[model samples]
Target: MSEHPIELSTRMIDTGVVDTPSNRVTEELSELADGVAIVESFSHVVAVRTDDGLVAFDSSGSGSGAQVVEALRRWDDDPVHSIVYTHGHLDHVGGSAAFAADAEDRGRPRPRVVGHERILDRFERYELTSGYNRMINMRQFGGAARSARRLDERPFLPDATLRPDVTYEDHRTETIGGVEIEMHHCEGETDDHTWSYLPGFDMISAGDQFIWNFPNCGNPQKVQRYPVEWAESLRAMAAKGAELFVPAHGLPIAGRDRIRTCLETVATTLEDLVADVIEAMNAGAVLDEILHTVTVPDEALDLPYLQPLYDEPEFVVRNIWRLYGGWYDGNPARLKPAPDATVGAEVVDLAGGIDRVIERARATSTAGDHRLACHLIEFAVAADPSSPAVHEARRAIYAARRGGETSLMAKGIFKSAEADSTTVIDGEAPPLRMIRDLGD
Candidate 1:
């Protein structure tokens, strides 16, 4: 029996400035074991304890982490000895310092951080897209996407990296604090998600692999993930005879049969989506065409656990394309794209006058159609960026659609665009265009 008990915390909050409704939505669903208490750090700190020691997880450190430690204090004063990170996402890995600090004060063994080997790479990718990420985060919080100011540095780095700390080429087993645990490496959600099983408790802690919402197979802003691999992982977990399932986000699921059904349903949905996407690609369809073509069956969509609260099927299709096709979408016009202004100006001339486009934009915005309105306004803005009418129209259209958005990822981008259009109206310089200029 292992001496150190791994931890899980239920406490989490939006550490960033603009908190989305989804943040709260996700929080209300987090759960831990019965005898083993759950703690809330910021809004998402999660931890668990056993006979040996404590094991905690999540990244809402500082305020969030402090809250988690306080919650644990409500139960036992035992020091935490093990920390398991589900993946490298900021909210999951950011709160380590506070927990480690408290454990230090108690003279408990310093918590050993564990995570997938790819966490380091995840951090590097975040740094590379810092400007874009910062903007998205601001939008996610309902703040301005870009600041004329500078970076805030909230997206932190992980310490005590795990080279599969316990190491699993595919699946591996370990016993922490006398709690029999199983860890499986999955390529879903994030590239190296760890789905853990505690046999003694008949509980399964599926990191992001099995969230209550529809699988986040199609995150709009992040890199590619393997849908096939994700499906396989879900099926593998469903086969486990766990009576209790604690998802990283959302409610706890009980009963072996129900859990198996939920797991199987998500797995099948992803598999179908991937198969359909690949079939479309094989038919030589472009990315946009493929995205518009693939659809999730209403049966799967109807599942309460399969809500599209985070990501949609279209985004997953695009991610799959990236996995197979790299950056270029095989369109020769985009092989070496011209500047937006250059293309927009030519397109505007072809469509007649810029005023004609703005008139169409006004019409679309008036009809309560932001998607078309934004498309028209983007051309006008890119070409005749100084037009106040165009700016106001863009801002208004985005605002109308913003509240209707469901996922934080989607709301963030749309809100940011709205803010940028307003900034242009207020005589503030917009963000550097190079941020979204793919080749740039």
Candidate 2:
């Protein structure tokens, strides 16, 4: 949108813009240093020129892969020496096939795709949970929120997705064209995450571990994240004294001091959250109490790099508890809880009817208690899921909920809920489950 992607990114970074064009893949290449550059994509491709060829970190994504390769070609035709996966996330590594295809077209051996040893397991798990991934991803980004559209039955790890050819245990160091690159495994967003550093350039190619947003160790839809170790990894990268800091998803920072502040602030935020959550747990507070009572420093959140735009702090607290404790939230009623519909039907009977509950939910929502309003609406929907009136209220309430949220995670989920209700109101045969209920 600006003259250049980096300019756009830097402007957003300086102005504290969370909805950034940097996250968009333009398939344009910009050089940061001699023989080093970045290809702007959904997940960027950071390349280092080597006598052997080009060493690239991350390959955009499946849909954007071909464009990313084309963008890099416009800058340099050097065959890719290697492609490093910052992590196994689809956006980061999904484009590996394009890189391999390019190598074949140029009559060269495929670039070695390198990643942590756990990546294979991650891929395997994707295969096992493809439906779930499709559901969550659609909710996270597609605004599909339990939509009636057919979920993709194919494996989430597509045939185009490439497994890492070069795997390392914890740390791996090697020289590509005489420049040393260090890859270190850090469990944060993903257990198999790796961040690379080039001492020669004093630049760190931080994977999602240091995304511009608050540490994504709190992605509610995903697996257990390592916040404690995530902070440790950020500190480790900061201690490297890197001059140029390139993250997988945001603006590349140039100054050493700026880079250190970002790394330390994010690390400190996580460390503080961990300490507070653990203290609350030790003091015999339930998970709900800790969730409501926990507070993140406003100062930390005010920092550009530490914005809770994607994953916020409270989710991080829940993740911390999950890591240290079990799924049991210390609520005996929920330990072996009755089904929502059963409980909601009972509540509806005591409260007069579903209509009365919906009216209260509307008032709660009007009073700016969207959280409580959603709860009441959910109970109403559970009690009489087929009622158009209940769904209409759900649609409006969730739209309000989505509007008030800052983080993408919260917004996406709320938007999806809104979409779900909208679907029923529109009467497009609802998600198959709803149709089945109608038949019953």
Candidate 3:
């Protein structure tokens, strides 16, 4: 048995994060709506009553905004005075149009929309990377990528831009209807994240910075993230001494000590992880070599709050490398490389035909050597996508790989292989696993 108990647990589990699947709206919404009324499209919504009207934050990405609006209707018809966005992620701002439309109908003041100045730039970049974004969304949502719809328009745009409206360079204190909101800007999971502190009520909304899982500073398909800066931000928030810390993605945390310890541990782990990677790089270790060598401290990884469910420390190391150093990993072969298929075909030919590669892949896969099996099968498939043996080998490798995975990135890669394979993996399995026993 592993020494660490938290390795088998997650922030959602340790903190007792529960979103009971109910036809009923969230109790937070149910209670808050009793007077000023606010609905959240998805399960994650925060509503606070101010002197002027109600201010609601974030409509969930899954089109649950209508449910939130309806829940608010049950409470009161008082217009939504404001809607503040923590960041520009699709999940955070995808359902704004519905609430905006509702607020328009009552001759009630249109909710003044607010977000960081960089959000507009964030949206435009999404427009540029629409195709890539579509592919990633398909993987995240477990569906075929949205090919027919315009990715740019598919994500709803915010109104009355906060591009500069009520913008703060570092921090700002704003009171809406007598409710004091302390705004602090920090770059973490996203470049444009803003955390709101309701000092009067002793509540804070942490946006993506303190997402229940590991800090996702190293997403495989997204822009560069600042892991070191992210750690600093987490420390800053922890120092605020908030009584209630409500995160954008998971359950709300009550009590100062719990919130502070959780956030500080995340910060310390990341800053140390970055230092580890930097030390390895300074010693002239290459990227792949460093990935195999560097590791976050065991104590940090064992923390319930820092599970690598979505992203891993190695990914963060890679991001840091990209930020400070160029893409060159000091490898001459990759400096001016041939296309992937060309290289794969050469590898397959050297292995004495595709059949030999397939056979070897099957043996490796059966032996639970998925990393090796994946490389062999991927080369075989890439060299000849139409070959039945290649397809079979790829499917077998993918299925074997899925069984040993923990992080979301690994699962997504295996799932993509399954999707492209001629034969699917036999049965669906959960991604949750014990992390400590599987060690460096």
For TM-score, the strongest prediction is: 2
Runs off by more than 4 Å, candidate 1: 1-34, 40-46, 59-63, 127-132, 141-143, 148-155, 158-169, 434-440
Go through the candidates in order and give each one's C-alpha lDDT: 0.67, 0.85, 0.68
Please write out the lDDT profile of model 2 over residues 246-363, one tens digit for every residue: 8888778777876787788888888989999999999999999999999898877876677788999989888888999889999999999987777788989999999899999999
Question: How does residue 401 of candidate 1 score in lDDT?
Answer: 73
* Model 3: residues with Cα > 4 Å off, grouped in runs: 1-43, 143-168, 423-440
Overall local distance difference test of candidate 3: 0.68
Tens-digit lDDT string for candidate 1 (108-221): 766776766677677788767766666565566564646532556644344432222443456667777777767777888888688787778788777778765678877766
Model 1 CA RMSD to the hidden true structure, in angstroms: 6.4
Q: Kindly indicate the candidate among 1 and 3 with the higher TM-score.
A: 1
Candidate 1 whole-model C-alpha lDDT, 0 to 1: 0.67
Against the hidden reference, what TM-scores do the models get? 0.85, 0.94, 0.83
Candidate 2 CA-lDDT value: 0.85
